[model samples]
Target: MSSEFPTPGLKRKARKGGPDVPMWAARADLVKRGYEPKTVRLPYRLDEPDDAPLLSAACLRLQAEMLEWSSGHLRDPNRFDGTIRSLSRRYQTDPESPFNRRLKHTTREKDAHVLTLIEKAFGDRLVPSLKLADFWRWYDAAKKPKATGQPERVRRAWGIMKKLRELFAYGVAAELDGCARVRDILAEIRFPQPARRRVTLDLEHIEAFIPKAIEMGRISLALATAIQFDAVMRQKDVVGEWEPIPEGEALTGIVLNGRRWVNGLTWAGVVLDGVTRKATTKTGAMIAHDFSLCPHVQQVAAHVLPERRVGPLIVDEQQGRPYAGDAFQREWRKVARAAGIPDHIWNMDARAGAITEAEDAGADLDAIRATAAHTDAKTTARYSRGAVGKSRTVAELRLAHRAVKNSA
Candidate 1:
C-alpha cells in the first residue's frame, strides 16, 4: 500500500493488472531511476524478530549484507559480484555492510548441483513460466532407458528440479497469485523407481556357509557370517569391535563403535575411542544397548588377536588390514557361493532372518519390536507377519476344539 519508491525513468511500466514485481524487478526500477541496482538495499526481514523488527531500516541493511556475503562465496565469484554491483548502484548504496557478518552459515553445493542439472536438462526453458508437465517429460527423457546401475543419480536429478520449484514458489509466495502453479508442479513430479528388495538368506543356507568359510581358512569371514546369522546384524554392524558398555557381561543388544576401522572390517583395526559419538536411532532417542554374542559369535570374537589396547573384532588375515565395504561384500559373496546358497543373499537378509527366527522361536510381538529397535509394533509385525498368522491359526483351532469338548 505504501509506494515510497517511484518507478525509475528507464524502468518499464508495470502491466495494468500484472502481478507484483520480484526483487529483480526492484533492481530494474532502481536502474531506471539513474541508480545502479547493486547499490540498492533490497528490504528483507529476518524470521527471528529478536534480531530485528520487520520493515525497519536496520532489517533492510542486514538483508543487503546477507546477500553480499552469499554472493561473494559463489563458484563464479565475478558473476555474483557483478549482480551485487548492479543492485548496489541502482539502490545508490554500497553492497558490503557490517550486518553481513551475522548471515547464517550454509553450503549451497547441493542446490548448485541441482540448478546445474536442471539447466543442462531443460536449457533456457527451465524458468517458472514453463508448465510442470513439460519438466516431467524432460526429466523422463534425461534418465537412461535401463533400470540397472545406480538409481541415485537419477533420483538426485529429480531432487534438483524439486528444489528449483521451491525456490520459484518462495520468491513469488507473498505477491504472485501463481504460487499454486509452483505447488502443482511439485505435487506432480514423479519419483524414480523404488529400489529392488534384497534377497533374504534362510537359516539352512547360513548353516551350510559357516563351515565352508572356516574350512577355507577365512577365520574372520567365518566369524562375521556367524555373527550376521545369529545376531542378525547388517554387514556394517558385524565387521567392527562392539561398542563397549558398562555392563558388557549382560550382553543385551549390539552397540556399534562410531569410528570406522582403517582397513575397514577386513583387516585388524582399532576402534578410535576419540571418534566415538552418539547417533540418533531412526525411532528417535533410545538407549544404546550391548549385543549379546551367541556361542558361535563368541567363538569368532575369541579368535581375535589383541594388537593394541582396543581394536576391531575381525580383520583380514593376508593384509592384516581392514576390509572396506565393497571388498567385504565381494569376499562374503564368494563364501556364500561355496556354501551352496544362491547368489541373491544380501546383507539385509540377515535382519529379515533374525526377525523370522525370533518369531519361529515363539517370541511375542513386543519382544521382537524391542530387539529390532523398531519404533512400533506395527513395523515389527511387517517382518513377523507370517509367523503371527500361523500362531493365530493354531490358537483358533485349539479354541474351537475346547469349545466342542466342553459342550460334550
Candidate 2:
C-alpha cells in the first residue's frame, strides 16, 4: 500500500489495480500520545450516486482532535481545571474515584446520567464561585417544564442537587478552588427531599394479589409476592441480579443478554427443611429465613413448577431469565393490577407491610429489625410507617388498662 494523499493524524493508502480513492486511518503517532478513538475510518462515498458531501462524523472528530492537539488542550481532561465539567470528568473517569469505586453499579449508572446533564448545564461554571442563588437557578433548570409539587419534578431536582453536593465535596477534597465555601453554602440551603411513599401493600391486598397472580398463570409473581411479603425481602432479592461478564475470561455464569446474571434468590439458596439463606445486596448482612415461619411461603413452594425448582425461585416465564429491575417492576405491576391492587401501593411497600404486620402481631422490635435485615432498629421503623394495625393494638391495650383502673 502507498500513501496517495497524506494528512496529519490521518492517511490514505492505495493498492495496485484499486481505484484512486482515499482510505483514511488515524495516525499511529496519535495512539503513541494516548489520544482517544485510536482509529478513525472516514465514511466512504457511493460511486453510483453523484458526488456526495465529503464531510462525515469521523472527519469532524479528526478536525476537533487536530485543533485540540494544536492548542495544547488535548490532555486537558486528564488534568484538573477549576471547572464543574473537569470535576465531573474526574469523578466519572478516574477508576479509584468514589463514584466508581464506592457506589454500586446501579447507583453509578444513575449518577452517570445525572453527571452528563450536570456537565451540559454547568460545564464551565467554577465550583468556588458557585453561590446559593446560582445553584438554585441550576436546580430550576433541571426541574424545567415540571411545576412545584410535582412528585417527579421534585424527585429529579433532589437527585440533581444530591449529585452536585457530592461533586462539590469531591472538589473540596481535591483542594480545588472555592469548593469549600460552596459546600458550606449548600449545607445551609434546604433542598426539597423526595416525599416518602405513604401507601403500603396491605395484608388484604397481598392476600388478594397472590391467588390472582397464580390464577393468571404468573407463578413467579405469586412466589415473589409471597417471599417478599413473608420475609420482608426487597424485590431485588427475590428477582435476583445480573452482572456483566468479564472480558478475556471463559464465560461461565448465567450469561443473559450478554451480561452475567447472579445473586437473586437461586434455588440453591433454598436448603433442606424449608430454610433459605442469602445475603442482602445493599447491606452485606446474611439473612437466614425459615420459610415455615410463613404459611404463604409454604403454599408458594408447593406450587413451584419443576423447572423453576431447579433455577431461580422466581424466573420470568416469558424471558426465562432472572427478572431485571424494570422488567420485574412491569410484570409485578401487571399482576398487581389484575389482582385489584391499588395503583399507589408499590411492590416496594411489601417490605413495609410485612414489618407493620409483625409489629401489630406483637413481634419484638428487635426481631422485626432483624427480619427486615436492617442494621438499625430505626431503619426498620421507617418501613412500618403506613402500619395502622399496630396503632389499633395500642388503642386496645390502652382501653384494657383503663378498664383495670376503673375496676380497682
Candidate 3:
C-alpha cells in the first residue's frame, strides 16, 4: 500500500490488501473520447510469479485498447470451435460463409445433397481426424437407389466427395484448424474419373425426331428440337422465359444474357434479322450466330413464330406456360421412342449434334467453339463425333496408299 510507485488510479482501499485486484479502469475523459477503457483482471494472485506474464499481457492489452489499438485474440470462433457438422451447417445457412454466397443456385442444391450424405455418414467425425481410408470405406459402401453396379453409384458418391473437398479447401483458406487434414485426405483418395461420354445425335436422328414429335402433337417440342439443333441453343434457352423487346423499341434479334434475354428479347419473341447475340449459361461466353442464314433455323422459326405470342417461347399447348426442363425431356423421350430413335439419346444431344454438324461442315475450331459457346476449343472437340469417323476414314485411305507405294 505504501509503495514507491503506485498505479495512477489504483487505490489502496480498493485493493483490500489482496494481490487479486482490478488493475485498471477506464477514465471519464477516455470514455468521453469514445474509448471504452477496459478493466484488466487476473485470475490468480497478481504478485504470483506464474501469473506475472498473464497480468502483464492483460495490462498491455488494456493500455493498447485505451489508445485505440487491438490487443485481444482475433481468431474466428468458428474456425477454432468447429466440427464437420458445424462447418456444414454454416456452409448451408451462414450468409457470411464464403461458399454459401459464391456457389450458384444449382450448385448450391447439389452441395446441399452432398452435405446430407456426408452428415449421414460422418456428421459427428472430427474434421482433423478424418482419414483417406474412411472416405474409401464410405465410397465402397455407398449405393444409389435401385443401382446394381458399383461404378454408377460410386460415381455419384464420388461427386459428393469432390464437393466436400472444395468445401474443406475453403475452410483451409479460412485457416480453420482441422480443415487442412480433411482437404489432404480428400486429395489423396483417388476416385475413377468418369469419361465425358455424351450420346450426340446425328442429322438423321434430328430429321426423324422432328416428324415424330409433330405426329405426337408436341408441336412446341418439335419446333424447339429443330431450333436447338440448328441454333445450338440449350434446352433451358428453348423452354425458359425469353425477354421480349419493349414496345416501340428498335432493338431486333435475340440477345441472351445467361438464362434471361436482354433488350426485350425473348426466345419466343426473337426478331430474326440476319444475326443474334447468344450468351451461354455454362461458360458465360457471348457469341454471334446468323439465325436467318440457316434454312433449318428459319424453317423452325417460321413454324414456331406464330405461336410465340406474348409469353414463353416454348409453351405447353394445353397449359400455355413454359415447359419445365424435365417435362420437356419426358416429351422428347416419347418422340424419340415413336421416331425409332434410341432411348439412350437425350434431348440435349441435339445441341451436340449441331456442334458436330458445324465441325463436319469444315468450320474452324474457333467457329465451332463460338457456335457451342465452349470456353475451351478443346471442349468443342468433345461435342464433335462425326469428325472423328471422317478422320479415321481419311487415315485408312492414306494407309492403303502407303501400302501401294511400299509394294512399288
Candidate 4:
C-alpha cells in the first residue's frame, strides 16, 4: 500500500509541461490511495514563479477535498441557500453590503421600509426561485390599498415596482440564479398614471402661516418656514443641520467628515468691491443671494440663532436634537392645524411662493434659478407658478404690437 504522504512524482510533474505551466494529469498513486486523480487549471502564466506555488496549492486543495469526501465531510460552497428574507436582511443590516454602503442614510432608511414590506409578502421564498409571474403577483398585492383606504397613487406604485426590480437586480449582481433576467422580465410592467399636484400656496398663505407656527412654539418649524419662504430652499435643506464655522465661511463641493453643507448664509467667499460676496452649499447654487437683503428672513433667522449655536440649525424642541424627516412632518402637521392652514398647503409650497416672489420682483430666470438653488432654469419655471410665464406673454404681445405700429 502506498504511504499516505507527499507524492514527489506528482509535484515533479507540476512543471513537466515546461517551466511552471498549468498541468493536470491522473496519478496512479493518488487513485490507488482511494482518491480521485483530477486535473486543475489556474489562471497564471507558465513562466511566472508564483505559478508553481499556485499549482501546488490547487493540488493540495483537491487532495484535501478527496480526503473530506472519504470522511463524508465534503460540502458545496456555491449552494443556493439564499432566500428573499436572507438577502433583504443582508442588504438592510450588513454594513459591508453595497445596498447599505452605497446608499444615502435617508435612501437606506426608505429601502429598509421597502424591504420590510417585501419580506412580509415573500420572505420565505428562495431568491433564485422567483419567476416573473411571482413578481407580478407580489406587485399587484403591493398596489392594493392599505386599511386606511387611501388610493395608492400611481407615482408611489411605480416607486415600489422600481424597488422590486432593484431587489432582483441585487440578487443578479450577487450572482444568484433566478434573478438573471429579473429586470428584463419586470420591464413589461405598465406605468401608473401620474397625478398632477395643483394645490399651490401663494404669499398670503405664508404670511398667515408663519405667525401661527411661532404661536404654537414650533420655533424650528417657523424658522424653516421663513427660510423656505424667503430663500426657496427645499424642506430637506431647511430642516438639515449645518456645521457651524466661527468665521462664517462655506466651502462648496467639499465634504467634511461625511457631511455637506446644504442651505445657509455665510459671510465668506470671494469678497470684491461693491459686490455681495456669496457662499454656496450643495443645495445653494453657484450664485449666492444676500439673505441680509431680505429683512423678513433676517428677522426670522435672528430669532433662531442664539438657540441654534450647535448641531442642526433646526432641531426638535423635545429631544433637543435634529428632527428626523418624519418628525419634522408630524410637527409641521400640528403647527399647520393650529394655524388654521389647509391640509393641502404642503410645507414645500412655500418654495413655490418664494419662486413667484422672485418672478414678481422682476428677477429673470437666471436670478431665480440661483436664488432657488435650482440646477435647471426649466425647473425654476415649474416653481415660478405662472409668474415668469405671464410676464413673457405680456412682453411678447407688446413687442408684436410695436412691430405692427412701426411697420404701419
* Candidate with best lDDT: 2
- Point out the worst 10-residue segment of candidate 3 by lDDT: 4-13
List clashing residue pairs in candidate 2: 128-178, 240-264
- State the lDDT of candidate 1 residue by residue for 1-408, as single tens digits: 123432222122334685322232234443464432322222232233432332344324434544444455322221222222221121222123211222211123344455555544443231234566666766666555456664435655466555555544443432333445665666766667435443456678767777787777777787777766665454555464322344435544333343224211322222222121122223233323233435555555555555532445566666564564367778878888888878767645776777777887777768777766677788766665345545766898999999999999
Q: Candidate 2's residue-wise lDDT over 72-180, tens digit each?
A: 7765564555567778888777776789779987788889999988877766554544677987887776666565655457778888899888987887777777778
lDDT of 4 by residue, 29-141 (tens): 55575543344333345445545565455445555655665676643433333456656665555455667667765567677787777767666564434576776676566
The alpha-carbon lDDT assigned to residue 253 of candidate 1 equals: 38
Best by TM-score: 2
Clashes of each: 29, 2, 5, 0
What TM-score would each prediction reach against the true structure?
0.51, 0.78, 0.68, 0.62
> What root-mean-square deviation over C-alphas does model 3 reach?
13.3
Q: lDDT per model, in order?
A: 0.50, 0.74, 0.64, 0.61
Return whichever of 1 and 3 wins on TM-score. 3
Candidate 2 off by > 4 Å: 1-73, 144-152, 389-397, 404-408
lDDT of 4: 0.61
Order of candidate numbers by lDDT, starting with the best: 2, 3, 4, 1
Regions more than 4 Å wrong, model 4: 1-82, 93-97, 127-132, 153-155, 193-196, 241-287, 301-312, 315-321, 356-362, 377-395, 398-407
lDDT of 3 at 286: 73
TM-score, candidate 3, is: 0.68
State in Å the error of residue 165, model 2. Answer: 0.9
